[model samples]
Target: MVVLATKCYVEGDARSRALDGMGSMLDDDLGELSVEWTVGVRDDDFVSVTVEGEDATVARNLLRERWGEIPTDGRLTAGETYTGTLESWDDEGFVLDAGTRVRVPTSELGLGPGSPSQIRDRFGLVQHLPLRFVAGDADEPARLADAERDRLYEWSRGAGRVNVNSATRGEVRATVNRAGHAGDIVTVERLGLLEQSIVCAEGTDPPGLLASIGGYLPAELKCVIP
Candidate 1:
């Protein structure tokens, strides 16, 4: 069983829909392998996959590589990198839901020149977005992974983007099309199962794109303005 690092926090029908969507996705990811898999959500909302078949080992590693995994043992070693979902943020820092709450201080964010909230806003970080972070040693502090920092910085340097949560990648794409701004976006990048980033086309305005599609998606949207 590989506990996926991304979460499934929606409730009721939304939750079912999310899991069903993931099931379909799993078919795409592990279909070629000779394995049968079951998907379930943990008590704390992290997703888990149980695979059984001749190719189970290969399937497990593929799943772990595709979606980061939470250690079943619940132990995080210092100096190792892990992926977590963005749970909340404050003046002090950001809290990631990685089986446990991994608190990353603003001083350790390394994204530059902003409060945690400010940095979140600038980067268009939506709630429940998956983020990669490096664990702290005894004398150090937890921080965003260098690769994560580079990714966020690259977003700001791009054409612009509108990050969103609470909607599937397909849903985001449909919303953009329904909003009559399909041409405004280059693509809807899937950040996680339910989190997406709409990469704007050159000359497209991130805020304007958000406004156009906001009404269509029952989700949170933030802009990464270049």
Candidate 2:
């Protein structure tokens, strides 16, 4: 069993739809392999997959590479990198929901000049968005991973973006088309199963794109203005 880093926090019919979507994704990813698999949401809301068959090992590795894995042992080894979903933030730091909650201090964020909330807003970070971090132990402290920092910094240098949560990539793309702003976006990048980033085309305003499509999503939307 491998616990995935993405969350399936929605309930009711929405939850069923999300799981159905997940199943389809699993089929696309593992069908070629001689494996049987089942997907479930754990108590913590993180998605978990159980696989077995001739090619189970290969399929498991592919899943881990595609969606970062949560350590089943529930332990973080010092200096190792891990992925977690952004849960909440405070004046002091940001709390990431891995298999467990990992608190990353503001001083350790490495993102320039802002409170944790400010940083989250400026970068258009949405709840449940997957982020990578380096684990810390007694002698040292945990911090955002260098690769994660580089990725967020690159977002600022791009042609702006509208980040969203609680919607699938397909849903977001459809919403853009429905809003008549399909030409405004470069692509809808999947940040997780339910989180997506709409990269704006040149001269397309990210905030304007957000306003046009936000009403259709029933999801949280924020912009990264370049």
Candidate 3:
């Protein structure tokens, strides 16, 4: 997947416009299309859409016609880089990376991190950690180490102790014993490359609780055992 930073005139409407433009292009050029929308963390008003297709040409054309534009800083070239810029009331647009451009809405720059590429990089570092699994009800308690344990305790003091084990084939097999819950099987896997899935008797949420674990672990440390 390719990530491009771009600016636009309508900070709140840009995502919809871009998606609409892409849909139009796809309908006219390609037979059918599929698109997925994801919410942005920085602002509830902003959304990001991921489009996939069998024809690369269609996708390229859609991006070019709708969201493609050089930044005001003149730092981008058509073939060299992709830049996102936002338009101003004066009819001029501001480059996302440009410091002096005020007409450009700061939110329109879309240069902030958390792009798929950035998330992928972050996940790469996290995948090396030893997988820990816990099973049972939400009230069940789990033990953690260092900042991870501390963070979990802070979120919910009742999180049961984790059973550490190696991950294989996208499953984490470990032994866990919680105060009120029985020892049960647990599996942890990638929801995407960037997020993880926790499966147990009780419902599972993404292991955002493990963010601290990632922070404390070395890049070379293997979080998953062979």
TM-score, predicted candidate 2 vs. hidden true structure: 0.97
Q: Which candidate ranks first by TM-score, i.e. highest?
A: 2
* Each prediction's TM-score versus the true structure: 0.97, 0.97, 0.22
lDDT of 2 by residue, 102-185 (tens): 999999999999999999999999989999999988888889999999999999999999999998788888999999998888
Report how far residue 133 has shifted in candidate 2, in Å.
0.3
Better of 1 and 3 by TM-score: 1
* lDDT (tens digit, per residue) of candidate 3 on 1-226: 2222222122345345434543443355434534332222122111233345465555545544443322334342212323222212222212222212222322322323354334223223222122111111234322212433233233233222222212221223221122112233254443211123333333322243233233432222112110
Among all candidates shown, the one with the greatest lDDT: 2
For model 1, the run of ten residues with the poorest summed lDDT: 69-78
lDDT of 1 by residue, 108-138 (tens): 9998898988999999999999899998867
Cα displacement (angstroms), candidate 2, residue 57, comes to 0.8
Please estimate how well model 1 matches the true structure, expressed as its whole-model Cα lDDT: 0.91
Candidate 1 accuracy as TM-score: 0.97
lDDT of 1 at 111: 88
Q: Score residue 94 of candidate 3 by CA lDDT.
A: 27
